[model samples]
Target: MESSSEFPTSPSSGTTAITNPGFPVSDTVLSGASLPSPPERTSSQGGGIPLSKTASNVSSHSHRQSFAENQRHPPPSPRTQRHPSFTQQAIQDLMNHPPPNRHQNPRYVGRDWRDVAVGELLQPDEVKWAELDMSIQEATKTLFQSSPNNVVLVRQDSSSKEAMSTFDHSDLNAYLLAVVGLAKPEEEQVALYRDISVKAQSQEEIPLRDLQPIFRKEELVKIPAESTLDKAIEVFGGGVHRILVTNKDSEVVGILSQLRLLEFFWNEAVNFPLIDRLYTIVLRDLQIGTQQIIAVNADAPLADALFLMSSEGLTSVAVVDNGHNVVGNISTVDVRHLTNANSLPLLKASCMHFISVILSERGVEHGRDSFPVFYVNPYSTLAHTVAKLVATQSHRMWVVESASPSPSAPATPLLQASSSLPPLSTLSPPAISPGRTGSPTPGSATVVVPPPGAITTSTPQSPSTQGPFSSVPASALPGAGLSGRLTGVVSLTDILNLFAKSSGLRPLDPSEQRARRRRSSSSSVRPTLDIGRENGRGSVDSRR
Candidate 1:
């Protein structure tokens, strides 16, 4: 296997705009580049109006009271004690001593806010892959072991710069659906063979080309090696998740991923006091993570939702109603319940069919229960947002509002969690039917929930009792619902972006900008997250 590759720090070349319909135009552009007009928005889409920075005075008062009350009496939970001390300490150190050259990419030197380049934030990409000839089962297993994010790169030469044939996460899923019977089959024998031979031999012969999108040179969006991180973020602003980074020869040097960018932002926020300093910030002030809501109707088959997420490279998708009311959310974390078990019977079935089996079958798994989606209001302060994220221990929160009912009838309040419900500890993980022969029984195989919430807090008797940053008690988020409809999303990554942008909100003194420029010129390589060493431990598990 190849080790992580490094590239030169030269300034990136030209900037390119994303053509995806879902994204907004970036606020900043490369020097001399004309800023593209932002796409217009419909009310349902939540884009037209400028986000308000000032929280209502009443909201301020209520927030103050809530904070004071929490300071007076803190709640107790097992999660707090389990937080990795190294993570906490590293953040604290970063807060006190932010590196003089905090920006990781050096290509941004001499650049103003509008001229800021995307290359500054670019890092050597880390992604998983499988050749087309590999079996699905083998690829899936190898992918999860090293890269739990579970989106594998299907390529002939994954690192190749030239025309690369590919199939994404969605293709793998669509294929699974076909083989398992939800999707129509091309031929009876092919389907039957897949069912028998695939399960029996654990391999398949078809190349990935059958499912790959037609390769077009223009389809592969590339950026020069020296483009600013701002340009990259703008490219992402168009809902493009990953972009190809290239050198003068147009040879691919690295891949920039939205997930990596978000991770970088989150890590930076933790290292700095930006969260506290910018407590008054609102959703309007920062770049929302996902431009268009990658949503599915609540009534849609779970298979459909999975396919959407897989195709979009999203871990979760909002479950909405015909009226566009955000109802619930389903993510990879929920999918884990099925994937962890002997899911031969469920893998190919509609989500409804599979959900039924889990709810009604035997051998109940401890942590595989389904749960409602957690949300935040668009008008809520960043302080409140961060509080909810920390309190719930969540990676992302849905932003929604109560939609106006039709003119024909009286309005009704949006759905709310009942205060009378029992504690989470009382809820059991749903049951699922046993697996085929050789499948691990509930007692034999240890199952772990995947992504966003994969960081385990404790060895629980039941997994359903908690989720990655599950619902914050209603009391904890007092007045969060006052803000209106689903506008945009603010994830842990957005929080980091806010911190990064906050630095640019005020123009740097020429002296300060010059100092930064000098620092960038002298910087050799950016510091890396040395997980094992940082934690003073050796094994990955120990670091966790």
Candidate 2:
């Protein structure tokens, strides 16, 4: 059952400064949302699965498991500082060349990031496609997508010396994509999501299971359904654009996402205190999604999901069970099969526990929904909510419709499961009877993707440096392993694509291509043939 001891928030205490590991800290700090992991074998000893980002060591912290048993969550870690010099220089370089567009500028006076979406900020070229996990798309009946936020330039050589590094704004987009779900994590790439959520309660690092999970009790900001825009302005301060439309049960009926208020007050409305205009920005006005939800079964392949995201566009998607209530969601670049689906029978002993924990969380299944998921009671405070998000470094949450719906048998052992995510057995597809249109819709199909090749992914111990992978060219990887799971190395090609798009430097058209007769060609500048939609809207849009 949900708790009803309403905990409402007061205004924020504002930003505070804190120190990082050698990095200067300010009140405006950010961190990763990941979980802890078990011990890892050193890469130097032999070929082992690369570490998951959120890995940790567990043997010393037996007492900590009880903390997690109590539902205390972990906190996400701040971005790591262990990058080579090249990576650092790249970041500084991007800071130097800022976008000129008022809408695209990250630091425009009075502008807040939460208030905007990529559609408003992205150039035509800037909008690259990403794949959605099958669960997210099928559960929501929408193609989920995100644009890259940042692109880091890493230079590695045989001598093990770091080369010149640069960070481009484009890189930032890629980072955002990874953060939200537009990009996929490399297989064995360890990322700490909520460093705090699954970390040892003690200050020192510990194994994932040993982390004392803390679910804080904090006040939240709640808006009554009847509250007016003018009234909301007085309460939320400068950026309170919209309010949540909730019912008497405190269930959200709709919301006034910031975009809602912007449409009404864009250029013409009187400039009132933003808090005041908040209430009237109804959920109906701000709904950025469509009515028809498209979804795939949880077992579906991520490649299928990515095809959906890249072709369709999505921000976040709702995961649903057979009953159709939303359970979870997946976003951005975290949906890679390499990192999330390495079925090595037993994960690499060298692969750290924290990263595995993150991997487990990243690919969790909520009943049958395709998206990864996490949960909280309906009554947690906003502060509690924020704490949970901060701890896990995940932006979305799942408030199970029924708090005491079901309980499971006590966990028997660790080997029974890889990470802490529920074993795949519990996941099942949502049930939807077919409409007159056709074959079984997305929900009817099984979306299970084949697990990745052996998790102890390493090349054969041959004299030549080329590993087993080198022996099998991407084209001959049996199925889709090569193109689908190649984040192991970052190439200049990916970086080039990122920069060109951010700058809106498009290529020529087919006619233009022929006329110039040049060497290089552009993606946006393509041989134009109609790849119009199956829907007839393409024939006569007045906007065109």
Candidate 3:
């Protein structure tokens, strides 16, 4: 990595923007870009002028989170990665540091505010793919020694882009996360599947216009220009994790996140490394390693979303309406109470809830549980991905590429994880192992690995078949079918999960990536928690 002096110090200032890195960074933005006005808000959609960012702030036994909900939507691209002065050396320093430790943590002690630039150290692009595809085990045991969930991603751009995710309904998925059916007293799995049946029976899908607006730009909060991190949070309430930085024309130019702000307080041994003092990187080449986004549309038929959660396997989605603005958020937890297993057999006819249970959190062999979506720009380093989880409290983040011509960007798994995925037959649900034979899988299916091009665009009949981000089997379930162009139904939220499967969020096998790491260690700064405490802290785990 090289070094530079042009990086922006504040999250909301005029910095580079975040861009989708899935496509080549050098690739120009698709030609027809224009300012599309927000569509009209719908009836079922109530408006509170967007809640004060703090109003929606969710607090828990150990953590607290809030962000500006009404903040304007910044342009898809951020200025952080595009600044003229951002260089490779700065990016290296950012990558070397983990999220929680990047900023000189005011919550704890030790470390300097000057050296504690929260979002700097980023991983080189060459190692990015290796990091995301590593399994949870590999990420924790090898790549980073922090809580397997708290590493960060670093980028090559001098902008020092940072990313992370937040859980909308973390509790909903927690119960089913670790325990298996054998924990009878806690045997909530099957019952959980049955509860899904109840929710479906009572709700129905509606048009996008029927939702309520969550927050409007500045309606709930304000981001003072380059403001101190603490003040920013209070003004935003707690929900404003990311604040959009727009230009005089109200055109979005950049963004600031709560996680990034928090980084200002924590610091340790994390530092950037570089072979040279300066190098230029493109916007796509610089971005947060993990991204967290929320989807909500108040008018959505509760049943439709529940089915979506299970079928697509998402923890939560930031629902929106016709105008492309977020509405009241719904999460896995909302659907859980609706799909209670005890309520399933009672109704007997609620097939929707039954299948939802099978889908929401279950995996092929065993239910892997649900996770909040992490948004990524595709250009972050392995270190960035690790850091995002820690600062934002997440295990995974979704990577969004460019926006589509707008009716809405369908969540189609259009891209490939790599060129080596197995055949679609191998990916078939029925082919899944006996370990899950009795599980409440939505379609009672087993998926075998499929060929690389199994779901390519050559087959035009695949309405709703998102190219690479979200791939719905031509027929995932019996009645879960679609019509033309799949429109809003094929949302990026759910499609992102499918993309994870295709893009290799969890590599089927990563011995190779691990081997590559060993070989490159001499030249790279692979920070490890295994060594011991940094300064004033207890053992690493206890301190964190």
Candidates by lDDT, descending order: 1, 3, 2
Give the alpha-carbon lDDT of every model: 0.38, 0.25, 0.26
**Poorest stretch of ten by lDDT in candidate 3:** 208-217
Give candidate 1's TM-score: 0.42
Arrange candidates by TM-score, descending.
Answer: 1, 2, 3
For residues 307-400, write the lDDT of model 2, one tens digit per residue.
Answer: 2432233222333322333323333333321221222221112111212222232222211101112343333332233333333333233443
Q: Residue-pair clashes per candidate, as listed? A: 19, 103, 123
Alpha-carbon RMSD of each model: 22.7, 26.1, 25.5
- What is the alpha-carbon lDDT of model 1 when measured against the actual structure? 0.38
Q: In terms of TM-score, how similar is model 2 to the real structure?
A: 0.25
- The weakest ten consecutive residues by lDDT in model 2 span 1-10
Please estimate how well model 3 matches the true structure, expressed as its whole-model Cα lDDT: 0.26
lDDT of 3 by residue, 471-493 (tens): 22323322122111111221211
Judge candidate 3 at residue 381 and give its lDDT.
Answer: 43
Q: Write the per-residue lDDT of candidate 1 for residues 231-294, one digit (tens) a residue.
A: 5554444344455666667555566665556544434443434333565566546545443455
